[model samples]
Target: MKISMTVNGKPVSAEVEARTLLVTFIRENLRLTGTHVGCDTSQCGACTIHLNGRAVKSCNILAMQAEGADIVTIEGLAKADGTLHPMQEAFREHHGLQCGFCTPGMVMSAVDLVKNHPNPSEETIRAELDGNLCRCTGYHNIVKAVKAASAKM
Candidate 1:
């Protein structure tokens, strides 16, 4: 099957198998490797990306499902001039990541969370991050990053 979509602000099209997952298309076809495939079963949010305007687990959907959709991966969060998004900067400043495997998904999810809750509380941040898991940190720093980024965003 052939599908077309706007990825990272660029119009893109590709030939993909019907069973090809969105994560495969993004990472393999597009070569945007920042979106990791931690768990193909969608238990881990490592494959999270913004589909249209909402964050979704890329491994959970087929490539064809994103046809004509607007998608944004971790790479898209940065400015063309290389300025990091506030959420990304917060993650770095607060050391929100360890092992770095889950960082992309965590940052992506945090962007969406802040969009929904501009000034999310610690409890809200914790509740919102329920889907994204980190085996490294205790989430104290991640929560702080999200809270700090909320103020900027």
Candidate 2:
């Protein structure tokens, strides 16, 4: 099957198998390695990306399902000159990541949350981020990063 979509602000098309997961297509076919595949199951949001401007776990969807859609990975969030996105900056400043395995998805999801709730409380942030699992950071600094990014926005 051939899938075509806008990815990271660029139009992309590729031939993929029917069973190809969106994450595999992004990381393997598109060579966008920033979207990590931490878990094959959808429990981990390590492969999360914005599907039509909303966050969705790429591991849970087929590449064919993403055809004709707009997808934004962590690589697309930075400025053209390579400056970090506000959420990325906040994560760096607040030490939100330890092993860095979950940083890409965490930052992407945080950006989405802040967009939906510009001034989310700590509790709300925690609730919204419940689906994203991070084994290294314990989520303390992650929540703080979201708050800091919210303030900047």
Model 2 Cα shift for residue 96 (angstroms): 0.6
Off by over 4 Å in 2: none
Total backbone collisions for each predicted model: 0, 0
lDDT of all the models against the reference?
0.94, 0.93
Local lDDT at 60 for model 2: 94
Lowest-lDDT window of 10 residues in candidate 2?
Answer: 129-138
Return the TM-score for each candidate structure.
0.98, 0.97
For candidate 2, the lDDT comes to 0.93
Measured by TM-score, how close is model 2 to the native structure? 0.97
lDDT for model 1? 0.94
- Candidate achieving the largest TM-score: 1
Instruction: Compose the digit string of candidate 1's lDDT tens values, residues 1-153.
Output: 889999999999988899999999999999999999997888889999999999999999999999999999999999999999999999999999879999999999999999998899999999989889887855999999999999999
lDDT tens readout by residue for model 2, 77-130:
999999999899999999999999998999998899999998999999999998
